[model samples]
Structure formats: C-alpha cells, structure tokens
Target: MATPPKIPGLGAFADHKSGTPRPATPRFVTAAAWFLCLAAVMQFIASVFAIMHSVSPERRAVLEAQHAAMTGNRPSLEALQNIDVITVVLSALVTAGAYALFSIFLVKGRSWARLGAGILVALTFIQLVGVSYPEGFTTLAQVVCGVLAIALCYLPESSKFFATVKSSRS
Candidate 1:
C-alpha cells in the first residue's frame, strides 16, 4: 500500500495525545457539523412549506386568526399574510444558509466558524423560544438540535480540536 500524504498543519486524525503539528478533528466537531447541516436542511424544508402555503386563502385566514389571538388585537389578512413569504425566504437564505456554509470551515477547527456557529445556534434557540409555548414535537426538535450543536462544539471532548497546539500540550 502507498503511504498517506502528510499535511503541514491540522492533518487528519491526530489523536489528542500525539505531538503532531496540528490537532486532530475531534468526533464532537464532526458530530456538530452533521447536526448543523441537518438543521439547515430542515429549515429549508420549513421555508418551502411556508412559501407553498403562503398564497392559499385558507392558510392566510388561519395565520391571520392565529396572529390576532396571540396579539389580542385583530389584524387584516392582507396585513399579516403579506409578509410570510418574504420572511420565510429571508430566514432560510440568511440564517439556515449561513449555518450550512459555516459548517464547512467548522470541520477544519476554525475558531471563527466555531464562534459564528455558537451565535447562530443561540439565535436559533431565541427564534424557537419566540414560538408559542406548549409547542409540539417540531419545535422541540429545533431546540434540541440547537442545544446539541452548542454542546458538541464546546464540551471538553471536542474542545481540543479547536485549541492551539501549544495550549493543548500545556
């Protein structure tokens, strides 16, 4: 068998104990990457549904009624429903798309990607919380994914992957 190519820094699969020039990509980061990607896919699906239903009169009526109930003030269907399509598209493109893009660099143990993911995950949780309480399984799923992504990235098991060699060695 041919020998594997050696990279100068952050090469493949360097165990935590090894004195390699670069730290290995830990399992936690790997898991977090998958989780973030999954979140993005799910968010995209949600956006598509929002857009598809947005033009339906029944859907518009239901949303308007729900809004009025939550806000304790009646609002016209045109006022409430007009924004749904644009809102969902913007959220998908910006929020979910950014998460998907950042996850690529995140796997390489980039600190900025890690920090961005953290902030994105936090924003996801905040958005989830804004939803009405006593939510169903779908809302729970969003919260769980966000929390899990944060935990996987920051927990000690995977933290070494992002640390500088000098710090991890000390």
Candidate 2:
C-alpha cells in the first residue's frame, strides 16, 4: 500500500505528548460552525417570511386586532407598518455576515471567534432562562442556538484551536 500523505505541521496522531500540531479545530468550534450555519439559514427564512407577510394588509389587520384585544392597548401596526420587512432583512444580513466571518475564523483557528461564540451562547441561554416571550418559536430557537453554540466551544476541534492560539501568543 502507498504511504499516507503527511501534513506539514502534524508529526503523528500517536505522539500526543509531542509538540506536534493537532487539528486546529476543536469539537466545540465545529459545533459552533454548524450552529452558526443553522442560524444563518433560519434567519434567511425568517427574512423571507417577514418580507412576504409585511405587505399582507389583511393579515396585519387581524394580527393588530388580536394584539389590541390581548394588550388592551393600541397596536403598533396602526401605520400599516410594513417597515418590519426592513428590520427582518437587516437582521438576516447581519446574521449571514457574522456566520461568514465566524466560519473563516473557525477555519483559520482564530481564538477570538471561540470566545465571542461563547459569549453569544451565554446570552442566548439567558433568553431561555429569562421570562418567556409571547412568541413561543422565538424562545425555542434561542434555546437551540444557545445550546449549539456552547456545544461548539466545548468540542475537541475548538479546544485545539484555542490551544494553538494560546501557544502562539505565548
């Protein structure tokens, strides 16, 4: 059989104690990458829904009436506020952009991305632990996103990335 191809920095997987390079990615980072990708896809779908629903005046009216009855207050849809479409689009764009940047950093073994992803996970967890919002799906999504983000940070690939980064700094 032919010999296995050699990676430049990696000495051998068996030599774990040596100063050989392991995979730059840890498990957590891989999870985080998947999580971010999911979030991006969800955001894109939500943006499309928002854009389509924003212009549905009939649907808006029903929602507004329901809101008025539930809250005993004037609904914000009074202006026929299709402006929410913009907000949704902007959110989708921002999330997509963040995902792209995070993916690049993940591939390059950037430690800062790991830290930032951790922080985001914490914040998302807070959303789950905090009071439930009126929207059920939003809460569910937040919990899923948070859990995945945390999982990514804890993975082996992520650990390696962080370790490499620390070693470089020192």
Candidate 3:
C-alpha cells in the first residue's frame, strides 16, 4: 500500500503509520474538551434550577391563577405541569450525557465527536430562549461554554488534529 503524502507542518501527527509516538493533544482541542465538560455540568445545574423554579410555590400560584382564569380547570393544569417537568428532566439528562460523552471522545481525537457537540450547542441555544431568570443565568453560562467549545473545535489547529487522527485511522 502506498503511504499517504505528508501534510505540510502536520508530518509529526501524520507519521503515526510509521509507529512514531502520536502527537500530544493540541491545546485548542484540550480547551474545547474542558469547555464541553463545563457545559455539561452547567446544563445539569440549569436543569435543576429550572425544575425548582417551575415547582416553586409562587410559580404554582401563578399557574393556578392562569388556569382558573382561563378554563377554571385544575386537573388539566396539574397534568400539563407534570408533563413539562418530565420533558425537561429527560431533555436535560440526554443533553448532558451527550455533552459528556462527546467531550471524552473529542479528547481522544474522534472527529465525529466535534460535529455532534456542535449540533448539541445549536440545540442548547434554541432551548435557552425565554427561560426564567434563575435558570436563565445558568443556561447562559452553559451557552457560553458550549459556544466556546464549538469554536475551539473548529479552529485550524483542531481541524488539523482531527484530520491527522482520521488519516491515521485509515
């Protein structure tokens, strides 16, 4: 089999086929991974805050008043709230899990992990709109970390690193 041509300035990373030691993870990728981990933690905290805020006495009172004013129905409103809580819990767990899993694979130089993280970041941004203040703050922090992670993962150094990993795998 013909050896692949060495990419300029990436010879060290691309030479894995020759059994030389693999290049150290790039700083950009490392930073991206840490940012992803931070995002995951922040997402979980934000979810908890959201759940607390949603079930607070004050919020319950407001919801009750709204329901009473609209349809004079309590049972339906209670059911709706329960569904909302369950949805939020499930969404939070899935999102945080994806962020954590992708971060681990990203550190190990999996090219697909970055793409998955980027998609999650986009979804997080959409989910954060119109959140209540307490949870909003945590969500905002998570968004910042997620944005930074995605940005870092697309940087030139990170791109090269992923490319090297992909080529080595082939």
Instruction: Give the best candidate by lDDT.
Output: 3
TM-score of each: 0.64, 0.57, 0.75
What lDDT tens digits, residue by residue, belong to model 1 across residues 1-170?
A: 99978776643224456565656778888888888888787677666666777778888778867876775566677766768777878978997778787677667676667778888877776766556433323445655776687788888867767776435544
RMSD of 2: 11.1
- Compare the candidates by TM-score and give the number of the best one: 3
**Residue 72 shift from truth in candidate 3, angstroms:** 13
Model 2: number of backbone collisions: 10
* Error at 63, model 2, angstroms: 9.6
Of 1 and 3, the candidate ahead on lDDT is: 3
Please list the residue runs of candidate 1 whose C-alpha ends up more than 4 Å from where it truly belongs after superposition.
Answer: 1-21, 62-83, 130-139, 165-170
Per-residue lDDT of candidate 2, residues 17-86 (tens digit)? 4355545555557666777667556557545665666677776877677667775556477454645666
Cα error, candidate 2, residue 115 (Å) = 2.6
Per-residue lDDT over 28-131 for candidate 3, one digit per residue giving the tens place of the 0 to 100 score: 99999999999999988987887787787887888788778775445777775787689779988999999999898788788788989998988888977777
Candidate 2 lDDT score relative to the true structure: 0.60
- Residue 113, model 2: lDDT of 66
